[model samples]
Target chain A: MIDSQKPASAQDAEHHRTKMQKRKAVQDKEVASKTVEKGLLIVNTGAGKGKSTAAFGLALRMLGYGRRVVVIQFIKGAWHTGERKALERFEDLVEWHALGEGFTWETQDKARDIAACQGAWRVAQQALANPDVGLVILDELNIALRYDYLPMEQVLADIAARPESQHVAVTGRNAKEAMLEAADLVTEMTLVKHHFKAGVKAQEGIEF
Target chain B: MIDSQKPASAQDAEHHRTKMQKRKAVQDKEVASKTVEKGLLIVNTGAGKGKSTAAFGLALRMLGYGRRVVVIQFIKGAWHTGERKALERFEDLVEWHALGEGFTWETQDKARDIAACQGAWRVAQQALANPDVGLVILDELNIALRYDYLPMEQVLADIAARPESQHVAVTGRNAKEAMLEAADLVTEMTLVKHHFKAGVKAQEGIEF
Candidate 1:
């Protein structure tokens, strides 16, 4: 009935339409089946860039909904990152705390690093307890956990005790297995290629 | 000299400091070697979420530096996404064009899909040609390329011919081999676990 009288292109279009129609029905059913709603514990990890970037993106999204966002940087100083500057524009909705001086190699003091992590964890606990906050971004928390700067059990306990409707995003490379197990969503940004190998320096607004 | 007559913790600390000093020297030299500067063709792909989200985050970073950003959404409609609404706050610095009405299954007309892709590609070419635009995001461009709605050769050619200092981020799943080859940086987001299978619906300000 369809392909007999139609031109080649028309026949192809009709065939495609039929196939798509079947797919749409299946997709619609699957989508309708998902009914549960809960705050998500999101983990972004791996060797590639954008784990923190994507977390900031989620922070921006929460701000779009007129929700409060708390950002606690665990392992790096808030040394003028473009995202930090941009998010700071939403003054009333954002609470940012950069707790560390720099990386472990730069600091080279285990005692100091542990103290800083403990300080950041205290701040994180307060944020988690606040039901008014919509999203809490614990940037580079995995690195602190990996180094055993803070007790992982206490961190997980605090996260579990957070408000039911509050979302949290934890980011860093080499996320712990227990952390991954606790997460509702986990994304690993795998590095396929890097421009640094080709002699490109980190540029402002591109990498920070 | 270092470990003699000292507490165990103090000796361990001294050893750590010495090791870190060596690592810092190596890091500083490697960083000093990279002096070249140029725009990058970045690709974000794979099955995990945040491909487009990361691109938008980069757009926000560019905006923080008071630079221009152009976003061309290849397949998704100009739906009420939180990121779009948030980015639209920077009216003067952002140019956003959401070309397609929806996905292939939703559209189902190859001709219409091709037309939409061509329209978006035209906009992309213009953005690529402009030196003022710091970053141009081709969101879901991989899907369009995978469907063969636009010629991969032409797409790559346009990107290559863009302004030297203009960065471009192409995002979507199943990126073409040629696209990956042409990119200066490539990040493949690998999905470890998603909440959707656990009956969790995509929440507003989280998924969108």
Candidate 2:
């Protein structure tokens, strides 16, 4: 009788252990699922067209969902056709700031353009600091960094420190490797095909 | 000589007549600062408080720079918290989608919620065709529209026709809208805020 009882007890203990292991596995899975987060970063680059346009589309998607968003246009100051006319309607929901005094060649003043870039950076810092802002798009920012108008290290640091829930996008040619690495999503817009190279200048209401 | 003088005078008159008019008032002010176009609609409605928090802070500001944006919040989505967030980040780039959905008890039932709303006619139609879709935030859409599973005529039409540049957002008390909205940016979070309400609860990150 003692031997039989011992065997039965041992079997019960083993069953309990198996049950505990299964429970633990389920709990671990639940935690993992809960911790999963969704965030996005879009990069539009290369010698192509529609970089800013793509960024703008993403920005609108986020906004329509009631996500707070910020956009900083780099190396573009002249009243371009699109932003000035079409984008201003949402004056209450959008903010537009021009950073370039004009392209470097047009102005022939690197120092002035750099100063303007610094001012834009200050604004970007403020936007990044805000926790409520969901998406921040740096339009043509890569060009500014390539030109050395904005400090690349500082920009990278700021992006790294942004609120975890926030999404940041950088658009322009030659996006820095650091920026690409920091991004949750990176898309390079290659010049597979474009109409402008055919000498068809940008038309109003279309390119703008 | 007289005949030659007459012809020259006529030529001068034509030239002067064609010259552009100069104004005493330099109307250099951007007459139409930005183009007014249809925008996406984002709705955030649920038992959670982060719907608008995520919407205004993350999406609206992104649209402010160059993307056309519009926001319409049903109910009292216009509390000081949301207002403060918008003021600080967007700089007047967002519009209030106000309808005073009122308290649940005051106007309860599917028929009433559906009746109160004119459908997503105007906003949805615009978002579908507009190309500069930066962001659209529809704060608290689920509770209002889901009371009856409201006919998705306007909503579906807009989504179907939405330009590549447009995106839509919807948030509210129940996830029924999520199913209906077919969101490109969807987030459903389990609640963690439990302190201040303590049974009769309403707190900052959890209730606002």
Candidate 3:
């Protein structure tokens, strides 16, 4: 019985050592792989104001990190005080595509509106497929989908198939059910009050 | 002379009418488009501690919106914590890939680390290429790039080639020069004081 006990004790000791060594190795490995790769998607929806503004703030944060970013403005084809000037500062780092035709009803030309949308969508598709892009913002795209100019299924499919580490953001009002369903993050900007309702026009830099 | 004046006045009236019509059209199309397309990249990087936390906050927001969000945690894959637990509630919308193999000296396996990084990058690439994915967050991509595990050039090129409206984000310590140059908006989070330096361990919910 003494001899049996001795062997059992020795075996237990060896097992413990092995477990310790394995754990240590795992810990060591973890330490070795200290780097990480992750991406984010932000959606600012609802009828509130500042959705785009908030998204832009996040974009600025990413940009400060020296990361690559892209912005696609949907219904906002006209020149705006904020993006028009701020985006240009990035120059090579930023690529802006304006949907020159504006909204659907403004032109009263369905063909022209669709063509402009297609043109803008082409750029968006390219940005989505590119892995180097750190951030891509779809400013005011939600309304485009609501107007039936852009296909929702195609958009959702593209997002699902993008690089896992890439980050994406969509800002606008009335976010569709599918978009909300497909998104990893959604923010609804509820409007409590607005200066526009009080007869104040959109101010430069502040509103645009 | 009288006839000439009459013609000039008529032409001026016609010009005024056309200008007014154009202005009215522009005003009528002020409704913002609401559409969310796939292929977005968001980056959260700086000297601050809340980059990842903020990114996760967005992920939670998206989950609440019923969207699926995949988080590939680099350099931080370890025991489960508060963020992990809270995200687990929406298992379908959230996924965590822990690649925190610890610091470089710990593993002493450069080849293995590279391979693992490539594997993780492949997943990221797939996510970026997907259209159905509304948001993709690269948790700590900056660290990987800083360490040179992920090819910076390839990353940049991929970003340049992505779809037009897709959104994306990247977060980490120090962003690369190339990344900042390509980003549309850049924001730097200056570090003030961190609690960790004060001998405080990570807290639940707040730090996790």
**Clash number for each model:** 0, 78, 123
Each prediction's RMSD over C-alphas, in Å, is 1.4, 17.1, 19.7
| Candidate 3: tens digits of C-alpha lDDT, residues B50-105 | 46655554554454345556666655555235556545445675667776565443
Top model by TM-score, which number? 1
Q: Return model 1's CA RMSD, one decimal.
A: 1.4
Chain A TM-score of each candidate structure, as shown: 0.96, 0.77, 0.77
TM-score (C-alpha) between model 1 and the true structure: 0.97
lDDT of 1 at B46: 97
Q: For each model in turn, which proportion of the native inter-chain contacts is also found?
A: 0.71, 0.00, 0.00
Off by more than 4 A, model 2: A1-35, B1-208
DockQ of 2: 0.03
B-chain TM-score for every candidate: 0.96, 0.59, 0.72
Of 1 and 3, the candidate ranking higher by DockQ: 1
User: Relative to the unseen true structure, what is the C-alpha lDDT of residue A16 in candidate 1, on a scale of 0 to 100?
Assistant: 86
lDDT of 2 by residue, A45-145 (tens): 55544456546555554544466667777776763445444345445555666766655444545556678889989988888898888778788899889
What lDDT score goes with residue A138 in model 3?
84
Interface RMSD of each: 1.3, 16.8, 17.9
Cα deviation at B46, candidate 3, in Å, is 25
TM-scores for candidates 1 onward, in order: 0.97, 0.44, 0.44
